[model samples]
Target chain A: MHLLAAELNPLGHVMDRNIIGGPDALLMGDPHGTPIVTMHMLTLLLATGLLLWIMNLAAKAITTGPSSEGNDRYLTRGRMAQLIEVITLYLRDTVVKPVLGEKTNKYLPYLLTLFFFVLMNNLLGLVPLLDLQHIVGAFLGDSHFAVIGGTATGNLAVTGGLALIAFLVIQVHGLRELGLAGWAHHLLGGAPWYLAPIMVPVELLGMFIKPAALAIRLFANMMAGHTLMATLALFGLMALSGMESWIAGLGISVIAGAFAVAITFLELFVAFLQAFIFMFLTAVFIGQLSPHDHEHEHAAETAHA
Target chain B: MHILAAEGNPVAVQLLPLVTTVVVFGIAFFILSKNVWPRITKGLDDRDNKIRDEIKAAEESREQARAAQAEYESSLKEARQEAAEMISKAKNDAKAAADDLRQRNEQELADLKQRAQRDIQTAKQQAVTELHSEATALAASIAGKILQREISVQDQQRLVEESLRELQPLK
Candidate 1:
């Protein structure tokens, strides 16, 4: 059982492993000797850079300057650029705009960056780059070496950091929209002043919990999907170690490989799903504090009618 | 299963990655906000406005075309009405002129017939007078022959009167 545990340890694949020099390298270590230039960090940086390049291309394809002629100028150029434009418009017009209203434009960039960045990292994680690196490192007599490739969003620290930013943006927006007194009044949740004692603390705790939930939800989902993939892959090796039968091993490998393939496709869907959820929830939180003009207009129209 | 038995913290939140994410995200956000979003929003807006303007222009031109067609139809109707009026007026004038010409021709024929009748009456009167004179002269010659002497003026007059009475019945 212990042997199986060690052989099938899925965390080894999902966990952040060091790349380049060890902790002894310059600017590489904290006081506790945790390597700063770890696999997840590298992935995060790579995803960010990728996002920048993609968005720049999308921007160029989407925009037609003044003095442009013909109806074709309105069309988004290239399939990839069109796809990006569609997604951006969907999120802006459907997801965020209805909630944020006039403030949708103000918050769109941050929301878009969050969604694409997380999605990129999630997609990159699904690639077999980490496994390839491991195989290459084994040949070089360095089994633990990794240059890149891991789920950055799968990391608790990374998701927590994202949640932290979302929390800050939501709170800052709330403060700006409501001011100090109105913000406090919101904590009361439209209840009487006498209930402030119970409501204020609950509301305050709710604020922290909202972002915390966001972090855990994203991190657990990404980590579990990756761990499942690793586990299925290791099943074949485990079968070989046990029975020493070539047919048994091959059969288990084939079955496990098929399951792994299905999981990969599922993971692809989850990557986009998770990104959308994160952005949508963040927008919801922002909308909670800043009640938009559309809602008031609706109420006014209803009253008139 | 190994997750339960794994050594150290399985879900540890490291300081480095957390900090790196915030810093990196902030940089990305700053760059994209400055460069990308505005242009895309503007492009969408421009397309929408252009479509609206085109639809409005098309509608206006359609209205103008409808108005022009209506005006043309009205003028065509008026022209037809004017032509009908002119034909009716011409018909009336032609009829009136024909009636006047017929009346003038009848009046001229009557005047020519009356003049011929008057001329015939005068010719008859002149012929009667000549006959009477001839008869009287013949009677006077006969009387002179019987007596074998010249006749007087009174005797001649008496004989002419007697001859006129005798000739009256035969005239």
Candidate 2:
């Protein structure tokens, strides 16, 4: 039981680790050494690569010209490509367009990339690749090797990076559209100069708070979901190893496995929902600083013309 | 209990993964913006334009058809009105011609009746003159036979005239 406890620590499955040579090495832990390449980094690259490949295929399928015989050019070709097109169009038309208005086209690429990347990472986390890698490492008598396994979005560093990018986009766009004076005026929270003393700091804090919330929300949701599934899986492992009666262990394993399956499905839904929320909130923040009335009037005039 | 304890490294924000995620995300955005998004957006725009044009064309054709139908209906109404006028004129002309023919025929019949009446009067007068001469000659012959001699011209004329005067009162 003691040996099993050491071998099957559930935290090890959910936590980030240095794949190459670092403090969190699976075989020999290096407490002082800084990680050059971690598991989450590898997962992030994989997700990016997968995103590029999938989007490339979708673009090709969507952009292909009509056949000589029929008007099939308008139709998105494959199921997967069609699904990607649907999601892209939905986010553009429904979520981003109404909020961003004319700027939707300019910013759509970044938002779309963010959504698909986060979603890919979230879904990759749900796969049992990490467990399979560990099982393979154990079989090979080398417990230190991990090629690609872990939730990149679940990590604080990764989610913080995404949120930081969102923050930069929002502020940069705000500055560009509002100029220097207009941007400073926005810090007043639409209040008179007398209220600037209070509103400035509050508005500044709100700016940082918004991105921080985004990072923490995505990170906590993903991490908690993975951790819950890991915990449920740990119960099954404990039932197998810690119990004296094999029948009781088997029964508990079944129950824990059932619960784990249910959580896995929930995590799948969370994966999509979290990605959507991140993109949607980023758009909303950007919309707040944009010249709403001017752009709307321009659009209305153009439509009239 | 073991799960709660930080057996391995505690979860914290690190530098490598953060930088890596930013780089990866930037690369994905750059590549996708250059290659994928523009094409997809263009496709959508093209499809929208095509649909709009098609709808406009359909509406135009509908309008043209409606105009043609109206024109055809109006011309049909004109032809029907023209035919009705012609029929009424033809009926009036036929009635006038028939009245003229009937008046001419009635006038010719009256003229024929008058002529026949004149001819009958002339024939009656001739027949009465001839009979009177024949009756005078027979009376003269009977008187001569009774006197056993031919009567003189003057005596016959006087005797005839006297007989005609007596017959006039009987006629």
Which predicted model would earn the best TM-score?
1
> Per-residue lDDT for B1-171 in model 2, tens only?
654464454457888888998899999889989998998887777777878998999999999999999999999999999999999999998998999889888988888998899999888777777777788788888999999986888888899999888766534
Model 2: CAPRI class: acceptable
DockQ, model 2, C-alpha based: 0.42
Interface RMSD of the candidates, in order? 2.1, 2.0
Fraction of the true interface contacts (Cα pairs closer than 8 Å across chains) found in each model: 0.72, 0.76
What pairs collide in candidate 1?
none
Task: Report the C-alpha lDDT of model 1 over A11-110, residue by residue, as the tens digit.
Answer: 7778776553344233454445657487788888888888889888888888875466478788787998888888888998898988788898888888
> What CAPRI class is candidate 1?
acceptable
Residues A184-300 of candidate 2: C-alpha lDDT, one tens digit per residue: 988886668999899899889978988988999999899899888888888877888789999999999999999999999999999999999998888878888886554553343
